[model samples]
Target: MFGVTILGNNSAIPTLDRYPTAQIVTCNDQLLLIDCGEGTQLQIAKYRIKRGKLRYIFISHLHGDHYFGLIGLLNTLNLMGRVDPLSIYAPPELEQIIQIQMECSGTALRYEINFVPLMPGYTGVILEDKDLSVSCFPTQHRISCFGFSVELRKKKRKLIPDQAKAYEVPAAYYGKLQEGADYLRKDGLLVKNDWVTIPPEKGKRYVYCADTIYDVNLLPYLQDADVIYHETTYLHELEGRAAERFHSTSVQAASLAAAAHAKRLLIGHFSSMYTELDPFLEQTRPIFPNTDIAEEGVTFLV
Candidate 1:
């Protein structure tokens, strides 16, 4: 089960009903947090999500709306006596900021915390564990921002039941066949692995374009993604303003999705000036019919 759950979707300011940017990506048994905006812990509780299951956190940039809640969340976790080690992947400056904050408060966390710094203007794979892989790429934000791509790989080969039975392969050997192992019969005949299994299916990918202007350079990272989350900070009417702020409009997000042929597009990071969200879908759907608003507390299956 690979999917992303939106916790906070608002842009800069936080309204009574809306929040800043934050999301949780569930890859099989592991949980990875994309951004930790303010009040993220409350949002987690609101959704009944298992916060303890979280193992990794990725911060896109130094924007306050993107990571203001990180320290608060860490404090709460330490207070709750969490002993499991946690790792955070973020820009190099974030480590010093976090360390200074912890130092001033004289707070010593019980669990080990590992900080992996992402250099400015750098884009490449950062982590790969089991079937889960995460990579970061540059985004066109005012700061040295990044976008993340999370992919879940299919490592096991597909078992062909008809071929396996035709080869007189025992049911007990099916597991080995899925693992791409040939079977040896008692009579000295060999049952080829290809006769019983096919190659693994393609991986599923979810790309989070944190904050960026309408730029085609992002297409390489977004190509053929199963699900994509792109910020739509304004309507097309404010396209110039969006460009000035280095943000994207709903129409731009839709166009990129159409270009990349992504399975689905999710639009969020809405500006506070807009009270209604229907216009976002109205503009995006005309270009990419599968576009959906990244509503808070909603989970999109990738």
Candidate 2:
């Protein structure tokens, strides 16, 4: 159930065939929308995503392509009569911008919206819910940009059914046993928690390098990720332009994925000039064989 769905993958401009930048990360039952570029609402509808499941939004930077659709999406949520609280994580200025837009239109949302700012040069854990934890780190971009690392944790203890059955433990109490509770027999014998269950397994992680230049400092943030989405805004031949613009080339993205030892790499945020996406994959696969295009309308499991 934990995966990422690409909505838009183009950078700087929106073309008929490509979009700006947007992604939906499904963390179990909850959905986190990242970088709501223009046409994001239409993309969501085209992909048939369950909008009601969306609970959080994360914007990497203030670039128009990264957050232009935010206000529209928020308005749509209000139009849908949503009452659940929505939390947004973004740079400090985004809150004021959203508020101003709302006020200018004399619009009020039906649901409560909370804003959590990612301060400049800040890095560390920013969110922790019952099943997931999210951390943010600065990326080398034109503006004050940040990347997100999401870890989905399993809290329940692993149940050993055989051990429980051997101890004459009833199935009715299995749920409690998984919660690390001790069992007491009718004869007053105590069944220790460890005798029938083990701690939950380690969680899996998905790291999103929203938009960054070819900077190796990001390796620490992407280390050992289950899946990583890094921007490859240009082909290897355009490395100079990419560096000058504070965007990454295909080779750079793959190199980072290889260095981080990530299970797989999803590259996108392509420049509008490149009508063909094959070059991006061709350049990255040679460096990191697991690299794949972050194709819109597709979901990648972490």
- Model 1 over residues 72-148: C-alpha lDDT tens digits? 99999899889999999999999999899999999999998899998888899999999999999999899999999
RMSD of 1: 1.2
Give candidate 1's TM-score: 0.97
Best by TM-score: 1
* lDDT (Cα, tens digit) per residue for candidate 2, span 155-274: 899999999999989999999998889999998989999999999988889999999999899999899999999999999998899999999999999999999999999999999998
lDDT of 1: 0.94
lDDT of each: 0.94, 0.94
User: Clashes in model 2: which pairs?
Assistant: none
Candidate 2, superposed: residue stretches over 4 Å from native:
none
CA displacement after TM-score superposition, residue 210 of candidate 1 (Å): 0.5
